[model samples]
Target: MLRRNFIAARDLEAELEQWQERIDIIRHKLKFIRQLPGVACIEQLNPPGTAGGRIPALVEIAGGTAIASEENGLLFPPDIVILMLPGKSIEESLREIGSLLEQPWFAESPALKNNRIYVTDCREYFQLPGPGMIDSLEILAEIINAGDFHFGFEGLGWIKFESGSPKNG
Candidate 1:
């Protein structure tokens, strides 16, 4: 009986891993998501001694004129990385927008976490133009799972969301 339980547990873990990979693929295929323009991607260098706060990378919005101050990083949950942009991306503009936006956090976090790219992708929309976006960090903290991911925008740049449950957007 104990042996059977062990096998079951191992299989469950494997299944979860497969699900995570599948979710990652789906996220990558998102036409709107991959093309988001991150203004800046701030990287939190893991030093020998320092109290790590949040957001490993900082971003600057392209054409949006938004900047991320360290104070803003403190506002988010430690686990989440926020991607900020000054403006929103229409489906037609996704490709161009993705090119304009930077993604330092997106690049660095995956390496830090052994290529768990999608999880890093679903950070904050830092410079998004909304009072609610800033205030929403706490709420995002609850909804974002350890391995899930998402993004959203609003107003001129108010879009936003989080990632979870391997499904199409």
Candidate 2:
């Protein structure tokens, strides 16, 4: 859609092509990891919504299954939990998540127990649908397959949330 829009406007063809090539390269690199089985739950806080969006598709592309809100009713604990608060910084997101920490389900989830909970800066990466989505994809890939991939997006794009840590709040 973005590409078509740019084409229609007759501008940025070179930039769009560059973005497409990068996206294709990342997709190719993630092929093997995509075959791996893992469940991920993404919770958007500020403008709360389900995992029924582009983020979920990004998760799948990065090699994990995103548990949608409907599926959440089944009480399936996700292996990875991603907290997204659009327009907020990581510190702000962490502060917001502090309230959720007291919830039994969130505190006791496998992701929290295993230190798989992550907080993301949605404003820069996941908030709007644009070329930056590729960055969002890379962030998810790094989080989902920590051992296998590392695109250096840790501190800037997202951060691992250690439950109960003072720094988190």
Candidate 3:
């Protein structure tokens, strides 16, 4: 009985269709990355007032090299940095983002030096295993790919990190 229910829940046909769509999108995205070298990115977060640390496996499916891994390996400076914030509230999240940007080490990181740091709500985008994964992939592709793409916050659940300014939720 359990096996039968599990099989039903699998929704094999829908899963296959989704997989096919993802493959097609990947093929299309790969064209743009063909001439470009792989980008190095790191996922991290700064809580209210402490030093920031790496977020594990956040970018594994994002098609870039993740400088921070779960093994506590030496971190390499990244080309792109994604900062995830705890979803306390919009105002608190913004404050934490500002705190992170103000850190001297953060300013010195390669991502910040190159203005590649992006801020997002961790819960909606990174904390859960859900359909948001697709949006996360798309967001990473837009940032890493060579194109004039700007990060937005409607359905993507993310926004560009701009220091000294508050992002209206």
Estimated TM-score per prediction? Answer: 0.24, 0.74, 0.60
lDDT leader: 2
Model 1, span 3-93: residue lDDT tens: 5435588887887676555444433443343333222222232211112223222111111111233532322212223332223232323
How many residue pairs of model 1 clash at the backbone?
34
Clashes of 3: 0
Better of 1 and 2 by TM-score: 2
**lDDT of each candidate versus the true structure:** 0.29, 0.69, 0.49
lDDT of 2 at 16: 79
Better of 1 and 3 by TM-score: 3
List candidate 2 stretches off by more than 4 Å: 1-11, 34-41, 44-49, 70-75, 164-169
* Candidate 2 per-residue lDDT over residues 14-60, each given as its tens digit: 66787687667767877765355345544554223345568778887
Query: Which candidate number has the best TM-score?
Result: 2
Any runs in candidate 1 off by more than 4 Å, and if so which?
1-81, 90-108, 111-135, 142-169
Query: Ranking by TM-score, best first?
Result: 2, 3, 1
In angstroms, the error of model 1 at 139 is: 5.6
**TM-score of model 2 relative to the true fold?**
0.74
At residue 103, give the lDDT of candidate 2.
48
On the 0 to 100 scale, the lDDT of residue 100 in model 2 is: 52
Which regions in candidate 3 have their CA more than 4 angstroms from the true location? 1-12, 31-60, 69-74, 86-91, 146-156, 164-169
> For residues 111-168, could you state the per-residue lDDT of candidate 3 as single tens digits?
6665666655656664444445555555665555525333454335555565443323
